[model samples]
Target: MDTTHRKKNEQNNHPRKGITEFDSNRATLRGKNIFPPFYVKTTVPLQEALKNGEVRNNTHLLVIERNAQILALLTQQMNYHHVAQGEIAGEPWMVSL
Candidate 1:
């Protein structure tokens, strides 16, 4: 058999590891907002916050603070493949991370 063909076959037979690598390097806590914080009405519109740098992709845990008081704890899983196979019912801005 040809060397190139043998290599291709080997690659095809190997089990791919995508999630393991992503989980290892992915962020686990909210560092800082890239943009100035602004009050927005809807959570679904929050994608603009991420894009415009108001909220950061680096933020794994979100805290809603108002007037120096802690409001809530946001425990979120921002994995890339979290919603892989489902079609979104509404037109929410998607962050294709």
Candidate 2:
């Protein structure tokens, strides 16, 4: 794969904006407008997320993701605390203490 050509090719390309389906168990909230090459998923409990500041005071969902695509994933959103770990689908939790 040519890195320069690839980068140039994607310079004008744009991802279709939309939320992925959960039925596939690979739901990805597209970051089309802001970060077209990125997406997110969350499955952690809402409170755990708040403690880690993964979501705001009013977030209702946590989207988690697996290791599949070469994409940028934002696990948590916070100023100081970020405790999210890489979680793969159908696999055991990889984080310990």
Candidate 3:
């Protein structure tokens, strides 16, 4: 066999040699967004949210405070989205878990 053909055969015989090859036929969720990003547009007062049972005392929160203003996001919601974005103090921010 030619040198090139011999080298190709050797590579094909090794499991790790073509590890980087991407097989589109085997891609199950290709070009899909499994976890769409979550955005927080409107917010309610913490006290009111608690009163309405929107947030419980034991609920985990990702909190950010600036200029004496506080923004809290539910960690459980963020877990499903994998990413959460919001505007705080006129500045945009994102959190990824």
RMSD of each: 14.8, 17.9, 8.8
Query: What's the TM-score of every candidate structure?
Result: 0.20, 0.21, 0.63
Model 1 weakest 10-residue run by lDDT: 80-89
Please identify model 3 stretches exceeding 4 Å from their true place. Answer: 1-29, 66-68
Best by TM-score: 3
Model 3 weakest lDDT span, ten residues long? 24-33
Q: What is the lDDT of residue 26 in candidate 1?
A: 52
**lDDT of the structure predicted as candidate 3:** 0.86
* Pairs that clash in candidate 1: 35-53
Query: Across residues 1-97, which tens digit of lDDT does each residue of candidate 2 receive?
Result: 6999888677657463343554554566665433222212455555665799876765543344445522222333421223334435544333211
Question: What is the C-alpha lDDT profile of model 3 across 1-97, one tens digit per residue?
Answer: 9999999899889876747878877778658779999988999999999999999999999887755778888889888998888787788878788
Which candidate comes out best when scored by lDDT?
3
Which 10 consecutive residues of model 2 have the lowest summed lDDT? 71-80
For candidate 1, lDDT tens digit of each residue in 31-59? 75443333222343456666888557676
